[model samples]
Target: MRVLWKIEMWCRKQAAAAILPLLLVGWLTGESSQALTTFGKSNTQPPKEVAPTAPPARPCSRQAECAGISSSSCVRTHYDSVTRCLCGDNSPPLNGQCEAQSKLLYHVCANSDECNDGLVCGAPNITGNAQPHLRVLTPQDKICLCDTESGYREREYTCSDAEILKTSIFAIIFVTSLRKILFY
Candidate 1:
């Protein structure tokens, strides 16, 4: 009888252990479900994004006040005598903001005329592995550099021109010396 009673107690303990957790879980789940239903449905759409506002304009007497603003300068309004900070074209423009002119890259040419004074449209003067393998994009594409053999042609000066240049130099020197002597 004692052995049977011990077995019965063990069965009750096992049943309590298994059933307690299940009951707790069910109770917790029901409570959560009720809370969710009462809370109503959540918004499915994403929150709208707001644009960042520009910094407020400030009073200024010089360009120093507009130093932080990109492409900004100091100007005095006709209505107001005090100078104010205004965003406009700045020298070379910060980060290329505003309608600023872009500088040309070395050896890269958009047109023959765009090249340096002596450079013309033709094959590039680059040597070794650095030479470009692909064809130029522009029909008259040429690197702006001194490459007399391929692109740039040397200006020819006649003997008469050389003599004229020498004569002009001598004349300038003579006139400068005469002026100095007379003034002294």
Candidate 2:
């Protein structure tokens, strides 16, 4: 009788352990089904569209006032007397923002500041005339050039010693090959 009672208690505990999880699963499923039914019957509206807002205009009276804006300065408008925040000499306004201009070799530029590092904006001596002094007057004539003060000679875009050595070797080989073919 004692053994039978112990076995009955163990069976009861086992049944409770198994039934508890099943009951919890059924409760969860019923709750989810009720939620689904309610969701289906509820009126759903389309999302409202939002309009984009433009940024507020920034006005300035002095260069310091334009310091918050990147690459900008206060300048009087050509059409109006009012001074406004405008892009600096090295930058131009694009898409309502000041953008720095990066001019490549021989590319037209407004000033030397617009040219990339190790380059200066100047006019090329295309007519074989005496090299003109560096000027920033005409945009059409200005181009990015090697900075002579940085040990870069005029018309040279690269200052790498390895590239120079390779070019010299190739030139020497070409010249010797041409001489051999001509004299031999």
Candidate 3:
């Protein structure tokens, strides 16, 4: 009788453990569905249509000519020496308007303004050791890199410049001490 009671109790505990999660999941799902139904629009309604806008003018000799277009300005192209309506310095023209590029590290950039804080758009070499072929490359080839002058330590991937100095000083002291111990 005691053995049967123990087995019954174990079964009851196992059943409760299994049923509790199912009940919780069902309750949560029901609540989420109810919330969605309460807040969402009816399926019978149609989405509103948006009016199409006129395309921006392409050719321009002055910024005033492109004033009608959003996020556009007049700039001279380096290749053809022709002044035309273009995007801002940091933004690139995409599909007819200026689009902002990602300013994160390692992302392709055209100028420093397109890069995040403490980063610059240039060759990755912080030591000025870029190859001759790479040196003649255009701005489009450049990428966002850490601005070492701003206290960014690329070797340690940190923003502390003092850490590198301390490390170098420690290395010099260690070498001198080792030399003294070996010679003397």
Candidate 4:
């Protein structure tokens, strides 16, 4: 009787082990179907957002007297129906206008009002305004620049300025440092 009971228990245990995997499969399949029904497709990838990386300061090497070349102004050559500016330079791209080249890099200026600084103002969609959107360019697109500082390579981070009086890199750095020291 004891051997018979042992045999029955072992068989039951094996049966349960086989059944559990089937149960788990059913659950996972149900979940997958429900997920597909809810979202248009299965969730495989997360959404991507544009993040602002700290742009390195522009750097000047030993031989280079000029940090970056400067152009007098960028003039636009054409706009289908919405754009208005008369910029001609292909180097620095302007907002709201189609770039002559797509692969060329341009810097992120704050706005057309102050694009020399790094700000990504959106482009416009309506009529009459020359630029449809802010055609933020990569630094390579910037045509002209003064000599950059030593030790700090010309990085196109969040817009920084040459003169402390002109912009707020001083105040921002000071306040951020103070907060870090006092609170952190």
TM-score of each candidate? 0.23, 0.26, 0.25, 0.19
lDDT of 2 at 112: 93
For the record, the alpha-carbon RMSD of candidate 1 to the native fold, in angstroms, is 35.6
- Candidate 2 regions off by >4 Å? 1-100, 128-140, 154-184
Candidate 1, residues 9-84, lDDT tens digits: the string is 7787677666545544554466745544545677676999998664434655444455575544444333444444
Tens digit per residue, CA lDDT, model 2, 95-183 = 55766546545445568988767678776555535323222113346556777777666442333344566766876776567545533
lDDT of 4 by residue, 1-184 (tens): 9999989877876776665455445544667456435546666768889786533222222112121233212222233222122222333323333343221112222334433332223332234542322232222333222123322223431223355443355656655675455334
Candidate 3's C-alpha runs over 4 A off are: 1-101, 126-140, 155-184
- Alpha carbon lDDT at 168, candidate 1: 67
Per-residue accuracy of model 3 over 9-105 as CA lDDT, tens digit each: 7787677666555544555466745544655566676788988654533755544565565555454433334445556442335566665434544
Note the residue pairs that clash in candidate 3.
none
Cα lDDT of candidate 3 equals 0.54
Worst 10 residues of 1 by lDDT: 130-139
Clashes of 4: 38
- Model 3 superposed RMSD (Cα): 18.1
